[model samples]
Target: MSNRIVKSSNLLNSFRYQIENSQKGVLIERKALLSSKNIELHFYETITRAKDVLMQFNLPVIAVMLQGEKTVEMDGLGKFEYAPGESLIIPAERKLKIDFPSASIENPTQCLAFIPDASLVEEAVYDYYKKTDTWDTKSDDGKIDFSADLLLRDEAILQTVNYLLYLFQEKNEHRDFFINMTTKELIIRILQSKARKAFLNNFQKNENRMTHIANYIKRNIGNPISVQDLSKEANMSKSNFFTLFKNSFGISPNEYIINEKMQKAKIIIQASSDRSIGQIARDLGYSDSSYFCKQFKNHTGYTPRQYERKHN
Candidate 1:
């Protein structure tokens, strides 16, 4: 997957905003960049280091980190570091306490805040279900509800966000139409990403057929597993299994298997120093070390050795 971290040069060239002198009590400065019937985009920059900064939003907001970092805390979600390339989904009417650990005039904290209209979100959800052919199903309502703040590092979401930022700054007659379309795409991506996360987090405890398949895969991840095996495990034909799995999780069975394997590979590489790349590949059921390295790069944008060096 391509890295979602926006390049500093892109932001500096596209978003040209002059920061005003900080008021007596304000910790973060905000500038309204774009406003429309469906959405609003704001540019925020904090120049001074600060802690326990309170922020409240009446509408559900998506904030993308452009530069610098923060430690964010919400009511139910414990505090965590928010860094560049990450996006946070804050629920409507939620209170957030943020700490800017590194902000200065030379390297101020920068982020983009998006307030999507309720109607816009509804339209996106409708389109998501319609395209997925799940609109008429009673089980899947395609609702966007965040139990806690979601931190997203998906490549698709970040690409859409970068496009939206570019569109917001362009001077064109059809800009609004393009922006609306892109915003809907962003919302759909968020929905799919969030659903996949929820399924992964609860699959161990859930008794659903998909969860059962997931459990089986994890239990035997280091073995040679095939789509036919998964279909048999679910007591369904291969074609039906493929359709149902893709519809439920937005990924093919093979893709999910590879994803899980790559995740396991990352843990193994980072947790121990004794294992070589070839040894790790064999442990993950990959007979060829070259193929494993290629798969790892495709999944994580880093080679095994590179990832180990960077993280460990």
Candidate 2:
């Protein structure tokens, strides 16, 4: 709760002293894959000044600042900030700088970073994600820019932090299977705790409202339905329904509808090489050929004709 987040300099020294020039401390390249989703808690600590920056040509990383503060610029996630009790996320294959500025001789910054190997995130963690693609689980190339101060106090999330500390400490000497077991548990706790919180926040009441609305829209994907009519089906005033729909899913209802339609349109276009753009557009409920082409071009950045020609 101290605004005095453990400064980067102090934590770095402590991490180095603890590692004691251990051979594993010399790992220039660290990589691991968790049995679970985007949960590779790949940890690294530097005792002396780290001259070379952390660079992975094609790997996604999600870092939890275990201790200290650090400024980083990663390949795809862009400029990011970190301090104790915060998670600094970077996309895979990003080139990043770990600026452990010299604050004082006595204290150096220490850090614990998690790199979500994309394959695992896609296969495991993403598979169990609560929300739809709106959260953008499809790509592992973004940052976790929320104020982690609000999230740090979460007891469950903190417990995972403690678990990481414990695992790394034991890993220093113990080759025991229990270290791996504890490590595995730490990953799962994060998914259930932090990731699940995200899911619950969105889909908690979605079963009836969000799901029903989405399902109805999907069932009528072949029909042209206006926002007012969709609002009526939800039994809420147009404005109120629009507000709630966006709040629950974090995008306007019309945008959501368009996104879903585009997804279906992409599939249809991809599947039948013979289907003309007009046929596909009509099946998807757009009566105006030019309008459909424009919408598709905006959503996908490729006009229907261009898309078909390129893909087919």
Candidate 3:
């Protein structure tokens, strides 16, 4: 909807100190020497007002802003402001023109970039597909199609990164083991973040159309939706949309819509205990509380009142 900057909980303050005190003449430090088998971590500090510096990576990279802000220009995604505590996912071999608009000698722009092997990302996606049992794994190209640019400042991922950075310093026996495992977990988390849900629903080739419709229904559960309107949105005739929707999601469109409504209803009921069941039903587009209660029971084996009672 609108641009929102996410702040990280686990920030690298010590690393910033290291950069500020490090020897001059080096704008950025390529810490390839400190890299592991699948992941490389690099730190960058701009000393001057650098603009339009071209950069491209052979593998997929996740860059986190540690200090100050940057005006970044990239192919396909265009230009945007990168700030401290924000993490950006850059695709393989994509050209980027970065500007250190706020960089200076006293307060330089510092950033950390984590470059992970493409194969690691593919492995994580394959494992997710296998777990879901939703797609034919044999047909998967083993390439990540991150159609949209992702900027994550998620608490969980920040915590994981903090742990990995600490593990990089510790000389323990299972340090690499933990680092690799956490890196894979980070990949999965990025793919499944709510920010990327809409893109994945509409653009991901395997679960494409119906997933889009599913997310659309979920996003607009409070509003009225008609089969005709949904068919139009899917760019298909009513009959064809219904058939394809059923084939993709294994449930009729109406059923899926109602299920989404009830799911939201449950959340609202649990979250706002002061609100009445009738109000929850009406808010979810159910005109009749009796009908809503019946449907809720049929779907979840719990009436609205009972569900509320148990949760409360």
Summing lDDT over every window of 10 consecutive residues in candidate 2, give the lowest-scoring window. 134-143
The TM-score, computed over Cα atoms with residue i paired to residue i, of candidate 3 is 0.50
At residue 113, candidate 3 shows an lDDT of 78
Q: Write the per-residue lDDT of candidate 3 for residues 144-256, one digit (tens) a residue.
A: 33333366667676776667677666678887777788888876776667434322332234245555567678767887788887876665679998888888878888888
Instruction: After superposing candidate 3 on the true structure, give the runs of residues whose Cα lies further than 4 Å from its correct spot.
Output: 1-33, 135-149, 194-312
Question: How badly does each model clash, as a count of residue pairs?
Answer: 0, 19, 0
lDDT of each: 0.74, 0.54, 0.67
Instruction: Find the 10 residues in a row with the least total lDDT in model 1.
Output: 198-207
Residue-wise lDDT of candidate 2 within 253-310, one digit each (tens)?
Answer: 8898888888888889878978877888899898987888888999999987778778
TM-score for every candidate vs. truth?
0.54, 0.38, 0.50
lDDT of 1 by residue, 1-312 (tens): 235655453354445454554557654554435665588887777778888888888766788888888888876667788888887876556678999888876788888888876667657765775578532211133333343326777778888988888788788899888889999888778768754333223111213567667877898889878999898766567999899889878899999999999999999999997899999998999999999999999999999989989999
Q: State the TM-score for model 1.
A: 0.54
